[model samples]
Every structure is written in structure tokens, then in C-alpha cells.
Target: MRSSISDRLSKMDKRLLNVRFKKSTASIFVLFIIFIIVFFFHPFNELTTVNLQSYPNLVDSLKGNTVISDIKIKKCFYYSSCQLNKVEQLQWRRLDSPLELYAAKPFRSLSRSMDIFNTFVFVKQASAQTVDSALVDVKITLKGEPINDSNEGWVSTDYDSYTIWKKFISKSHETFEQVDLVRDLDILFGMDDLQDSREYWQYQRTSIPVNAPVLPHLTLLKVPLTSHNKIFTEFHEFQSLKQNEVLLAKSNSLKIVQISDLHIGPDTGFCLDSSIDCTADLKSLEFLESSFEGESSSKPIDLVVITGDLIDSHRTKEFKSSILKSLSPILSKKIPFIFTFGEMDEVPLYEDKPEDENSPDESDLKVDTILKLNILNFISSLPYCYNKFVRYNQNLHGLTNYNMKVFKMPVNEETQLKLDEPAAIITVLDSENHKIDSSQINFLYRENQPLKSKDPFKLLFFHYPLPNYRPQGEFKLIGAYNDKKPLKKKTDMKFRDDIASLGYQVVSVGHEYKNDLCLLSEKIDRNTVINSMWLCYSSGAGASVGTSVDYDRKLRVFQIDFEKKQMLSWKRSALKGAFDHQMIHEY
Candidate 1:
């Protein structure tokens, strides 16, 4: 043999050069122990020399006896690969006292190498006092010089921006309790309107001043009044037909499952750094498990609404607990969902702080009051689902309007009359940015004069879409009155003829992400007649922002039957390839 095969190839090349010299000395001793813990134990340096550079004459200051009045910057956000394009010189100014002041001058450079900007500001605080040296002084400049190394760029004083003023100074000390101001003026007015709320209790006692400084009540984010009386006794197992209880009809077919503008937080993602995308939370829990787990779906979702910008402008509590843990399969399958808010569901109302710096409760409360206490503690930790306890008035509209009933029954037991005949009603409201508030149209015309008569199947659920259902010079302006003759109002076709004389034969909105329907005729009387209603518009299940349309990103559904009261179907499902629901119109 050729010298015994060259002695076994020279002992296999010295055992592969001693395994590549012990993997290059363990990768240079693990990059020199990560460069000696990032430069001699600087442990990622800059602990606090808080300069927070976003400045316009920097003033956030307020400290103890609290009194900053106004700041209002509103937006600076940028980070979709930071492209601002224009804005050459923005400015703002106010300073005679109510401070204000903001500047920006752009064209191209808005990001000094952008490392997260955020910036919504809004300050205001004259009393609900927890000042804790309210601070915020940033100051950086470039072509107008002044960048002086105030520790050159690293201001983060463990900020949650004073935990959104410590949960609005602990809910302004539980709204200065006197039994929560008589249960917030009995959910606003009605003891024959309690002397019309005496100018709302003199505007809440002259905006907090019975010797000011109030902060405590944060009972570490309370929530248990025995979990709101066990969610009002598990919302009477969805009140089978409460008029004292029983009348029947829990389902003659309703379905629904809407889900619009679900811009599920951390500004959702198609990458480009909006991060968190466990495959967009597994495609939003695979579209609520194929709309109530469809095996060729035969109708089971009986009600799940959502209808709003369920977050997109970052209302972080890990973006509302990753959109309620991707709607924990519609709250662990006890279905019956609801919610309405939108306008980016209490948008970027300032949050920043949660890279886990030992987060016990890094409180940033006020993404519309921490999304109404994380939706009343996730609908009182679910499990008992029948559904009713959605009262929430907070003086009529703030906690996003309410009222639901479905396929109801209870009629004349010598007319005890609780919810006499409701074969389906709904009415969620809170049309966030297409605005509303004429005290929410006089609290939905006093809760719709006790559910407007028979021909039931009402359905209103809002989140905008009324400026005569958008498109056509996109109208908007839903409220305004004074400012020395302001006027505004008009939601046109006379606000859908006052929600079609409060009987609402379907409204179902969702800030125009696309999917349409229309119908909406007009003339509400004066004999000239006309009528019609519908409206529709859902298109948004998240991730379809500027274009890449597939019907803008589906999710609608509808259904209804109530002994054929109308609308037998509706569609537009598509949340990624063949999930299909596609019909868009049905009767």
C-alpha cells in the first residue's frame, strides 16, 4: 500500500489542528468578557443626569405645591425608520405662565441618530399634587449651536414620566371621596338630575382646591371590591332575560365577531422595528381561532365586537398586555367580548418605562386610565361569562359608553317593566375621534328613551364613521359650540337622523381602514321622506397601514336573525390568505 496510506493522512492533520485551537481561544475569551462589562463595569453607564433632550426652552418644572398649568407638546413620535420629510420650523410658545413652548425645524434631520423619541407631553397639573420635582428639562441644539456636553445624550432617569403623574395623582385622590363623590354624582345626574350637577360640583370644587396636594389612593392599583362584586355576580350569567330574570331567547342567531382597527400595540408590526411580533401574536390568535373556531362555521360567536383602534400608537403596558394576551382566545373562550373606544384606543398617552428595571408596578397609568383598568381587570378575570355588568359611566361618557342586551324578552308581568322586549339592541358608542360628546348626545338620548319600542334588532357599536360615513371630502367635525361663536357639530344627514331616531337599524363603525357598505339615505320627516340606514365599515384587524390592501385587512362578519328582523349575513374575513369570509353584503 502507498506507505500505509501516508500513515493515515498524517494522523488526520493533527486532529484538525487541535480543534481549531480550542475554538480560537473561546472566541477571544468571550470578547474579552464583553469588553470588561462594557468598559470597566460602567454597567451600561449613564444612570441619571437627566437632560432628556427634546427641548424648546426646556421647562417641565413644578415640584411641590404643584402648579405647572400647561405643556402640551402632543407628538414627536417617529421611529418607522425615522422619515419626517418636511416640517421646517414648527414652534408653539405660551409662557406668560402656563408655560407651553415647543419647537422643531426639520426638512431632514429630526433624529440625532434616533433612539426612540416618543414625546407626547401635555402636562397641565395645577393640583392633584404628587409633584416629586416634576422636572423634564432637556436642551439640545445643532444648527443654532448649543449642544454643550451635558453628558452628551443619555437622559433616562428611570422614567415612566412620573407614572403618568402617579395615576393622575392617584385618581385625584379617588375623586376626593365622599363615597366617591356620591358614586360620581350617581353616574352623572338623575335624581331628577341633581340640580344639574351644580355645575358639575362647581367644576369639581374649583378643580381641586380644598387645600390641594392630594395623592394617595393608588392602593397599588386597587381593583378588588371583591373584584367588583365578583363582576356583579358574574353579570347575571348574561342576564338570561332580566326583568327580574327569565323571559328567554339567548340565541335565535346573532353572531357578530367584528374586530376592527385592532392596531394591537407597540404600533403593531410588519417589521421595520415596531418589534414584538410573535407572528403578530400568531395572527391575532389565528383570527380568534378562525372566528369561533370555524369548521365551516355555522354561527357561534354570538357577540364579540372590539370595533376600535385597539392600540397602535403605543399605549404600553406591554402594549396593553400584548392586546390582552392576544385576546386570550376571546377571553378564554367564554366569548361575549364588547369594547369600543378607538382613536387609537387611548393612544400614545405617554408610557415609556418597562425594560424590566425590576418592574413591580412601573405605573404609567392613563392610557385612558390604563385602558379602563385593563378593561376592568380583564372583565373581572373571566370564566363565568353570561355578561351584563358593563355599566361604566364615569359621569356618562369617559369610560367609553355602554348598554348591550341581546335577543332579550321579559314583557308585561303587570308591567314590572325592566328591559321589556329586546330581541337585540347593542349601542356601544364612544366614537372616539369622529368626536361626539354633547354629553355623549345627552347620554345617548337618555339611554335611548328606554330602548325605543319593539321592531328591535338595533345595533349601534361605534368608533367613528358618522360624518355621513366618511368619504367625499371627509367631513368630521362632530362637536363645538363656544370660542365666541364656534358652532361646528354636524355629523350630517343630521347625524344619521339622530342615530335614526335612536332605534339604530345598524351602524357598526370602525375608523375607516376600508371595508365599506353604505346604504344611509336621509330625510327624517317633514314629509319629504327617504329613510334607509346600514353604514357598516370594518376593515382592520391590524397591520394594514399605508397600502398593501387585501380589502385593507378584513374582519367584519355580522349575522343577525331575531326571527328574521333583517341582516341575515355580512362578511369580509381575510386576515392572511384563505381564512376567507369575503361576502361584504348580505340580507
Candidate 2:
């Protein structure tokens, strides 16, 4: 009877456990169904739709309803069922275009060939905006095209025959009436290149080519012809130097930093001779900024003279960019600065050729002149550039030939005195060809006639050292002279004698990278005592050029004291992080 009762109770407990499992399973199933219903029919979706409805134009744009198609077609045809293989075969049979023929047998220098071809297209477009837009479109269209290897499809005549470009423009026009093709290359490429058809647009300030060896197809851009189009201008506005005619200083002394042989390239350049890995351009800039920071508060840097070689030769195509990069540190400091042209400043890096052979295109004088003019226009347009555009002689051999007056502050700080006479004069000349021409020398004398009466302390700056600049008898040399031989032009003594006669006391130059010698020598005329001049060479500040690992990159600093009529100079080394071997001379 006891066993029968226990079995009945156990069966009743099992029934109760089964009922609880069924209830929990049914509850979870109901919750899952409710979650699905809430997720699909959420109020957040309706709120998003309501917000988009308020901006109809935005909704249209998001749905690809713009003037130009957001979806670019690889190849468009009038007929929907047009066979691509048939059209490609027809294009292959077409005669080779000028561009295709040029690409087949490009110039020795691939970069030069690309530059010429792109320039031709730019000229044909005749509008800066159109050219820019078209180039970008071409780059996009030929995105996967091989740069090193030739693609037969791109080398066909039909590729650049305006068939595709015309079709694109027609399609764009059909959709939108606001879009139109216009010619306007005046701002960047210059209208003069169009007017003077004899000269090609070699120095047009455009970006480098994306693809080389294979010529890119020409594409007509569907630009919006509206008043909303803002003309693209340079980042910095043109700053005149008239206000800075007289250099001002904190105290009685004027400090000038001479940085030379920057050899700045397109981007952060590679170190040519450095043992450690570094970016040449960045290191040079850091050295300059560090030197500026290490300056004495009482004698701050008042003037900066970048002697020359601001840009590297092999990469002269992007000289505008390179120059801006080189001068960034100086420009940031807001110090008044001047520039002189080096031999490599305007010359492009040409491929190796036989000494006796000559290529007409590579050695074209017109192209060279255009490049120099373009470089000058760019540099002169920058802010705080003390380069004056006024040329004493129209036929002056070089572009950067100008003079600046450095005035002395009154001893009494309380009294505002109007001083008429200048304490010193700084003359900057261009020795781009490694020699100063007779025309430049004559212009120098002509421009100095008025200021000659002031009898100011005259200092001259150029790129190349003059022949036999060192004194024969006795001279004091300061700093290292590690250069195998000073890179001087084999010119007559006329230039040296002329400047010496003009009361020039110091002739500072930059070209030899390894030499930083400052020699004070007497300038005697026919056994008679005359003024003593300082012939100084500032070492190369750029690491891209050949530099000694033992010697640190440096900048030559000049501090002129008007009261004492004295000038103190020293080398500010990058490794040393301070001034070294300070030398002083009284005028």
C-alpha cells in the first residue's frame, strides 16, 4: 500500500515539470515575434524619410540626378545593343594620331615627352579649368592602364580623335542645359602661349603626368558655365617690397642669416650622402627652424638672404612647389628675405648624352627663357620677398638684380628722428650661368650712382664665387674649407675690380657645398691701400646634395652693428645646434 502511494506522487510531480517547460517555450516564441515586428516597422525609418523629404534636391542628388552623371560609363555607345568587340576592332584599324605616333617613339627622356604631349593638349583646350578637369578625367579613365608597358588600345588614333570626348559632352548637354564646354587657359598656362603659337607651353604650371610612355586620351570636360565659378588663384597674394626698403632691427645691430644650396625637390627629398636615413628637405628645414629658435633675443634675425640653388636640377618641373617648401621656414618667421638664382635653379635635369651630340628640343633657348621667366614670376609673387621688379636696364642678363638700403636706428629711443642716409646697402645679383655678364656689371654701376654718395657699408650677394677671390698677400680665414676646389667662373678681374671700386666691402656667395670659408682680404688698387672686403662662402644647407658626414650642415649668420660699424658672423651647425667659430670685422 505504501509503494503504490509513492509511485502516484512521483507521477504527479513529473506532470507539473512538463507543464512549466511548455509555458516557458511559448513565452519566448511570443517575445521573438514581437521583436521582429518592432524592428521592421520602426519609427526611426519614418523619421529618416521625413528628413529626406524636406531636402528634395539632396534626395535627387543621392539618387544620381545631378547635371553630370555620378556613374561614369567605361565606354558609351548610341545603340544599347552595340557590340564592344566590333567597335574596338574598328578603332584598331584607324590611322595613328599625332599623339599615338609620338607615344610610339617617345623622346629619350620619358618625362620630357609626357610634358610636351600634355602641354599640347593644354594649349588645345586653352582654358585652365577645362584643362585641369580634363586631365583629372583622363587620369580617372586610364586608372588601370599600364604606365611602364604600352597598351595597344590607348595607342589607337580613335582614342584621342574627340569621338569619345564629343559623345561625353553631347550626353551631358542632353541631360543639362547649364553644362557647356568653354576655353579659358589664361590664368595658369598664360594667354601669351596661345597668342605666340611659335612657342610651346613648356613652362605651364600644371601637375606632372600620371601615366607615362602611353599617351593619355583627350577628354572634353562638361564644366558648369555659371557666375558661381570662382577663379583659382595662388595661396599667397603678391606682397610688394616698397614698404621694406629700409630693413629694421630690434636694437642698433641688424642680423642676417644666409641659407644656401637648399636643393629642395618635389617632395621630402632623399639624403644623397648622409650615413643615417633622413629626408633631406625636412632636415634642412628643421635645421633652419632650430637655428632661428637658438638666436639671441637681443639680436634677432632681421634679414634672410637665400643665396641660391633653392631647387634641385633634376626636378625643376615642380620648381614652384619646391621653392615654396624651401622658403617656408623663413616665411613663417616673417623675416624680410631676398633670393639669387643658382645654375641649377632654372635648368631641368637632362638625361646623359654624348658631349658632341645635341638635341634641338632639349637645348632650345626659348624653352629655357620661358622657364626662367616662369620661375621669376612665381618667386616674385610670394609674400615677404624683397625682390624688386624694377630693372635699371631692360637688357639686364639676369632677372634678380636689385639693391636694398639698410638704415641705422636713432640712438635716442624716445626721440623719433628722420634719418635720410642709409647705414648699409645690400646688393643681390643672379649668377645663374656661373658667370656675371658685362650688362649686369654696367647695370650695377648705373643703379649704385645715387646711393654712392651715402657711402654706406656695401655687401654683395651672388651664387657663384668670382675667380681668384682670395687675397694674395695676407688674409684671415674662418670656418672649414673642405671643398676639393672652389667652383669659380674663369672670368677676368673686371667684376671684382668694379665692385671693389663701388665701395663694396663684402662679397658673399654659395655654390661649393663643402666650403664655408670667410676670408677678409684687402682690396688694393695699383699698390695703393683701398677698402678691405670679406669674401665669404656659405656651405650647402641641403642634404640632397653631396655633403660630408663629418661636417654638419650649416647656415652663415651675419650681425651688423651700425653704432660700432662692425659685422660679426658664424656658422650655425645643424648637429651642433648652436653657433660655432664666431668671427668679427669692423668696417
Best by TM-score: 2
TM-score of 1: 0.26
Error of 1 at 497 (Å): 17
Candidate 1 structure quality by residue, lDDT tens digits, 1-587: 88888878877777787778788889899999997565444412121121111211001121122333223332233322222234411222221110001111122234422222333333344432433222222221212233344544323222222212211123344433221111111011001101111111111111110111210110011121123344445454444443232223335666776777756543223333344332443454456566567622565565677777765644232232344444556765656566666766553223444545442232433335444444434433333222233323334444556666664333335745446455666667665446665666677677667764666666777776665554343322211111222223444446667777776666767666644454444444575556555666665665545533222355666666655555643544553432423222234
lDDT (C-alpha, whole model) for all candidates = 0.43, 0.55
Off by over 4 Å in 1: 1-307, 310-313, 318-338, 341-403, 406-420, 427-453, 456-459, 464-531, 534-587
Span of 10 residues, lowest total lDDT, candidate 1:
185-194
Model 1 has a clash total of 2
lDDT of 2 at 24: 86
**What local lDDT score does residue 394 receive in model 1, on the 0 to 100 scale?**
34
Counted clashes in each candidate structure? 2, 5
Pairs with steric clashes in candidate 2: 126-185, 127-184, 127-185, 128-184, 128-185
Model 2, residue 346: what's the lDDT? 46
lDDT of 2 by residue, 1-587 (tens): 89999999988898888888889889988998887565434432111221101111111211221232111122222112222366454322221112222221223344553222311221222223222232112222233334235443332112332311211243333433344432222111111111111111122223223343322222222334441222122111213123345565657888888888888765456555547644566777778778888874546787889888888857533344467567767766666688878877844223344647554242333445556555666566455567654312235656787777776655345744233456777788877567777877887788677663455667889888887564466667777766645445555666777887887878888888777888766666798767666788888887654553333677888888777777777788887755555545564
Q: The CA-based lDDT of model 1 is what?
A: 0.43
